[model samples]
Target: MSLKQQLKDAVAKQKKARDITREDIVKNAAAIQRSRQEQKDLSNRPH
Candidate 1:
């Protein structure tokens, strides 16, 4: 679905019955955002 939903799903998947802290969610979100930006950059390359 949306990016927000994706992040929620990612966090949920990582939880796997463990407690998820705010910091964990923030880190996951940041990682996802960075990877997305990297993907965009790669696609924009002249290669």
Candidate 2:
């Protein structure tokens, strides 16, 4: 098997174990990004 195929298989196995859907990942990533952005904005505001 090629390296790409091996990686694909590993990812499939991990997804099955975690039962993580793409939407779940996207939602959590977006929420984290939003929080980080909010903190950065607050820190850069006029003192």
Local accuracy by lDDT, each model: 0.89, 0.92
TM-score of 2: 0.53
- Residues 1-47 of candidate 2 have per-residue lDDT tens digits of 99999999999999886766777888999999999999999999999
Colliding pairs, model 1? none
How close is each model in CA RMSD to the real structure?
14.5, 7.8
Candidate 2 yields a Cα-based lDDT of 0.92
The CA lDDT at 7 in model 1 is 98
Per-model TM values vs. the true structure? 0.56, 0.53
- Candidate 1 residue-wise lDDT, 1-47, digit = tens: 99999999998888864565767888999999999999999999999
The model with the greatest TM-score is 1
Off by over 4 Å in 2: 1-20
